[model samples]
Target: MELDVHKPTILVTGGAGYIGSNAAFLLSQQGYQVVIIDNFKHGQQFYPDWARVIKCDFSDQSILDQIFTHYNVEAVMHFAGLIEVGASVRDPKIFYEENVVKVLKLLNKMQEHGIDKFVFSSSAAVYGTPTKVPIVEEHPCNPINPYGNTKYAVECMLSDFSRAYGLNFVALRYFNAAGADVENGLGERHKPETHVIPLLLEAAQSGETFSIFGNDYQTPDGTCIRDYLHVKDLASAHYKALKFLDGNKSAVFNLGTGIGASVSELVNMVTKQTGLSINVEVKKRRSGDPDRLVADPSRASTLLGWKPEYSSLETIIADAWLFYQKPDAVLYYSDQSYQQSSVF
Candidate 1:
């Protein structure tokens, strides 16, 4: 399906970043007019033609006014924020300001504009080190790191807004988001990348020494275990959340495959899928590193009728390996008419 000129617009904040870009592309394919707001802080330059791109901070009041005024935005899918866990631990001020304070500004603008529907990009990190195997939505949130705390703070704000102002929203708390939308030319492009799969793929491709972080954890292989969900699957859930707000009150869901893969296992799988060897180096475990983190993901399935189609370990690695093989074709157009003016 293509974008219908008569269709209501969906404003996607941070829509040029990893998960947001994939979701934006999927929304475009589903015939929604996507208006993307991104600052391009990560140096991600791949902008698709399907969406109108606005190069600015999402919290910019002048730009927000223009966007809300120009487009008949039905809802907002916010994915723009600082996401590095280690960095968040290093300087918490930036994390809180970028992730929490800035988002408050955006929400204030949304409330002013009467655009009450929101689909937030939340994180499973909010559950911290889970007490059980698969974490459920009701899991107690005890975030050990600043990153997780920021996400939880946002969720709390959304909850408050929902109750006080009738702001319908869905906060999809995600496990690990991996893989690429190879068909749509979308892939992970984080600068100084920290994600496991991408780092492993780069190690395999370049024969670089990939540190295992720690091998003394309580898990089977002693490395940390995480639930890796495909980016495409995450994108679909965002769309589902958007549709869900059409009738339901505010809700939250965990998005994952309910499967766990250890770090060593992921390394081995990278070798298996890429047919290349990674120079392995074991190191001290980073502080706040958990033994395991997996999601029950039953609420999303039961509530939104959403399921993960490409979250299997095999499919995740396969798609990621394919994405690592080539350079991303820049889809940004130089024509001014194709870009949304950020100027007030």
Candidate 2:
């Protein structure tokens, strides 16, 4: 198979989804050719024009072989996987198949094609029920649920692959990924949206009562505290991880703001942003929820030179509100026009 060596190409596995789409756009802006493959199960039909979209599941080995045969894929940013913790708990089979088994197949194909660099979209869920606050990468990975187990399983697989096959990888274990690409008209649009930010926005806009599960946790406000990082910062970390892989090394980094915000604080932020008093109903805490899951992002900051630029509670809510208000806005790729102006 002939390869285009002039333009380095990145194959984004779930480039049509929320974080993946933004990563695709950022890669394109940084002058890398992007080829996106998504099943459209949880992703959207819209994407940047520069990216080549291939509608197929990552488990399809034949299709993957064809893609590797056609393009000179320099590296891969894998974001395609199931994320619902509750759903994973109910039916662990699908999570294993989609998240673990499919990813193994994709890695095998990458080995066949000699493409080694990988950036895995992992989760803070891997460090389930953290024994310490400001969780670090070395925290014991005792995932409390199947969704997190799948991610930890993949991280183990990546480690073995790197040791045996010389494949370099970076596993970014992210906390709550919130906010939207307001300039590009990209945001969270999950089928039954479960994220707190979007759910609160929906409740505020529609005057519906939103549920805050288990407010009597061991927190200052008796609510769960999570480290919310902006989607754009998460995307930038992917680009940085790709560059870091150029040194033929494997690493794990936590992606977050290192700041914890409780559920009550988030609700207050949304109310302030939208000027609508949101109604809330506190319920029993969901199973497998930790009281605090903030990140110690010093590793990512020191190594990748990446930090959360738009991760404040106020900015997160404001960006999400803009996207919620303009869901159908046209998305364009303009590097200079979309500069990070302070939203706070």
Candidate 3:
């Protein structure tokens, strides 16, 4: 579907973290009037000026009311929530409140203001322990972890709200969100980073050893395999999802390259990209582990006309390396002369 081509006001929640900011930046470039809502807890480090950024916690309904009033928000691309899996297990309440309740709050505000077009950021975690390879949209959702469960729960809520209140929504279930925007404008910069691409990139740049979680999975590499989609591609999927939300079409689509890479395979990719040898120590596997999780994004392609461009591992690593040295992590480090990751 072609965009409206007329710049219209759109609200973006969690507009500071990796994907949201990139979306905002690209939206602005596409001539859309964008408004951002983000709590600075995780966004302070990488906030973007591509849109009118308004910092507020989504749990506060009062604040959402004020924001909708202030911005004349036409539509919303919701990305506000806690995202770490292990951390979600430790603190499920925050995830539930932020992902579920806050979503309802946002919808209430949207309904009150007579706004309804919503593009939600859901996750493949919802398809926890899939019954088959290349999980489809129809796969049974049994999210083993709190993070996945919360996402799945919110998807249900959105579907219900759409039925009950005429809420036009699109839920994009994304796979491993990796890579930085190549232009160094917007990229992943999670604090105490847990993401493999950014974490590996940081370790390589800082000259530190990255710990591998385990090395005894059923994959050929003896490590867990994951489909690593570049963050920019993820943002583009959001863009597609946003455009897909027309006058009367609510949908759900998976965003992925439909391929899996093991942890060691990723480390080797980084090594190959940087031409630098890295150290890794394998540890015990975590409890909620899926041997191989790859998504079949046929629906996204068929519905949203979305397909990943940076589907190669080398491109992901090379682009990420540029962002790390010049943009994303340059301010965080003390030493500037080092060209590669090693013990400083």
TM-score for candidate 2, residues paired by index: 0.94
lDDT of candidate 3 over 20-126, digit per residue (tens): 88777777777788766677688653434445555567545766666566555668998878888888988999888878877877788789889889998999999
The TM-score of predicted model 1 comes to: 0.95
lDDT of each: 0.88, 0.88, 0.78
Candidate 3 similarity to native, TM-score: 0.89
For residues 1-344, could you state the per-residue lDDT of candidate 2 as single tens digits?
12254578999998889999989889989999887778879867654566776777877787778777777789999999988888999999999999999999999999999999999999998998999988989889999999999999999999999999999999999899999989877788887688989999999999999999998899999999999999999999999999999989899999999999999999999999999999999999887788999999999999999988988888888999999998453464322211112101
TM-score, each model?
0.95, 0.94, 0.89
- Expressed as tens digits, the lDDT of each residue in 136-240 for candidate 1 is 898899998999999999999999999999899999999999998877678788887999999999889888899988999999989999999999999999999
**Alpha-carbon deviation at 227 in model 3, angstroms:** 0.5
Q: After superposition, how far is residue 264 of candidate 3 from its true place, in Å?
A: 1.7
Q: Higher-lDDT candidate among 1 and 3?
A: 1
Candidate 3 residue pairs in clash (backbone atoms < 3 Å): 204-341, 207-341, 207-342
Off by more than 4 A, model 1: 1-6, 332-344
Per-residue lDDT for 194 in model 2? Answer: 84
lDDT of 2 at 176: 90
